[model samples]
Target: MPQIFRIVPYSIYFWSNESDPLEPIHVHISEGRATSNATKIWITSTGKTVIKVLGENPG
Candidate 1:
């Protein structure tokens, strides 16, 4: 995964595998590099972000 940005306790990124033609544009958020516990947010064609999954620590 390549990190897009970071803000304190959270890191925003996207996996390189996302380049697959079947995948939509989206982002993954996690505490540090624990991607197994990350949350997924899908960027809709309408330019909105929809939470696809909640992280282990939703706080």
Candidate 2:
């Protein structure tokens, strides 16, 4: 399950596919792609993004 929001310019914000639809999993946000240097965030059930795991380290 992916949740996308309409945001402003230069903001590549979009929820990619979930790791598993059946499982909520750890509720932690991770990089959608292992090889991707992209940033990810943990989201609530209400589709609100939490600032829990922002692994935006310089590559």
Candidate 3:
């Protein structure tokens, strides 16, 4: 995993292998070590952000 940045107890990163279908340009955020169900933040071409909370309770 490539870490983009960290804030407090969270890590924002991207999986090197990525997903099979390949999501758009996105990053995952999670507490401590990154998880498979980490929240995904997608970046649109227009510079808008779309957040997807995997599993549950990513807050």
lDDT of 3 by residue, 1-59 (tens): 88989997889999876878877899999988888898899999999999999864344
Instruction: Please give the CA lDDT of all the candidate structures.
Output: 0.75, 0.40, 0.86
Q: Evaluate model 3: give its lDDT.
A: 0.86
User: In model 3, where do residues sit more than 4 Å from their true spots?
Assistant: 56-59
Write model 2 residue lDDT over 17-55, tens digit each, in one string: 645554232233233323233445555688776554345
Q: Of the candidates shown, which would achieve the greatest lDDT relative to the real structure?
A: 3
Q: Candidate 1 has what TM-score?
A: 0.73
- Candidate 1 or 3, higher TM-score? 3
lDDT of 3 at 35: 86
Worst 10 residues of 3 by lDDT: 50-59
Residue 13, candidate 1: C-alpha displacement in angstroms: 0.5
What's the CA error at residue 3 for candidate 2, in Å?
Answer: 11
Worst 10 residues of 2 by lDDT: 26-35
Superior candidate under lDDT, 1 versus 3: 3
**Candidate 2 deviant stretches above 4 angstroms:** 1-9, 15-35, 46-48, 52-59
